[model samples]
Target: MQRTPNWSLQQLPDMDMGQFRQWQALLEERTGVCVSDQRKTFLQTSLCARMREQQMDDYQTYYDYVTQGPLGAIEWSALIERLTVRETSFMRHRASFDCVARYLHERLSQPGRQTPLQLWSVGCASGEEAYSLAIVVEQALIDTGSSKRDYGIWATDISLQALEQGRAAHYPTGRLGGLTQAERNTWLTDTPDGRHAVLPSLRERVCFSRMNILELAQAPLRDLDIIFCQNLLIYFRRWRRRDLLNLLAKRLAPGGMLVVGLGEIVDWNNPLLERVPDDRVQAYVRRDSSESLE
Candidate 1:
């Protein structure tokens, strides 16, 4: 009798287009996930590695494993963790922060206009963007003796794992370069291991959550403020982008600011937002008022 040899998933054939489409649909349905054709390479590498780890010869077996309940949930969780890109570093864009600094200066310089300084660091991957916002807010406070004012910051992302890392608020040495000399002196301590630690003071100011923009229709955010929903809409289908923009309009305070990534579009003539001075930044001021939300 001939013996049948067992092969790991890596030894199996490449994913056929049909298998890819099925997996894509199932993933989107599972989490409103959307992957561009450009990311096919990323999908293959991550999924295949997990399949091979199970000693499965093909995707069907791997798919079965994930659909098998509790154990499957664990596998799927791991898969999602690997698939998502958590690429971020401090102060990735100097221009945006500069804008923020200028805006806060104007606000704080005026009397009777200061209250709890609220800002949203939307898509704050790995905590850097959130920290950056904290720094900006802090500088404004110090300059105006407004440090005693409470700050409301909500940093949210679709990946729970990414949010976990952000909550930790520690970074390797290279990531520290994103901070300026004065910022480092105030908010960070150099670790012996060539890493930098974000002081608890700065970290505590930010509230982190696992939130999908699509599911944030009920997020308890309202009134006049600043929103930094940056660099996150690149993956959405066109229709979804419009849906998100409309939703954002409702949340923005009248004369409040909405800052989108360079990749985002608000169709400035869309009747909801008036374009700010800088066209490329996609900054807009809301036309809605608190009376409308009520």
Candidate 2:
């Protein structure tokens, strides 16, 4: 009998269209992320990277392994961390933050408004967006002479590892591209090894947790003052995007602000929400009961 070869060290075979569709369907069913046909290589690479670690060779074997049950559920969690796109930085979109600042400034100017502003950073990977919001809110309060008003950020993502990183609140200098020298000095603490950590004041204001936007119906978040859901809907189908926006709209308090990526959506009509027209940013402001859509 011939000796069997060790298949684990062998390179992955070219993924066929059927296999690609299988994996894509699995991802979409579980996570609502629709992988395009062109992203076959991306899916293969992500699957194969994990497979190599487990010493599993064929995509079929890996597929079986990932769909097996309680074990599969555990494995699936690990896989998504590697698969999901987490490329984000501090203030990835300046216009959205500027819009947020304006909203907060208006609220701060209101008379007898004591409620601490509640904000949610949906799909917040590694915490930069959340921390940036904190910085923006801090600056906004100061700029509007309402320093006494309080606010907090609920930063959530599907990846537990990312959430842990968010909780740690440390970031490399390279990721601080959007921060100005003054903002950096005021909001971040320098470490000896060259990384910057968020200041305690800012860190304390952000709460990081693992959350899946697909399961928002069960989520504890409600009556949020602002919801920032940018750069995330692009992976979802149009109907799912509308579903998510509708769910997010329900979570917003009256007069709340919802900021999404520009051009990610168009004509998402909701009677209670009106789009804030800006040349650089796309946003919606929730209306009071009297302003319901016709």
lDDT top scorer: 2
| lDDT, candidate 1, 30-50, per-residue tens | 666687677777777778666
Candidate 1 stretches with Cα past 4 Å from truth are 1-13, 67-71, 266-270, 288-291
Candidate 2 lDDT over 1-294, as tens digits, reads 122235466755678888888999999998889999888878887887777677766777788888998988898999998888678999889889989999988978889888899999999999999999999999988988885748889999998998999999889988897888999999999998889999999999999988888898888787788999998999999999998898888888888999999999886887768888786998998986623221
Task: In angstroms, give how far residue 51 of model 1 lies from its true place.
Answer: 2.5
Model 2 RMSD in Å is: 3.0
Which candidate has the highest TM-score of all?
Answer: 2
Shift of residue 93 alpha carbon in model 2, Å: 0.6
* Candidate 2 regions with alpha-carbon error over 4 angstroms: 1-11, 147-149, 290-294
Which residue window of length 10 is worst by lDDT in model 2?
A: 1-10
Residue 46 of model 2 has an lDDT of: 88
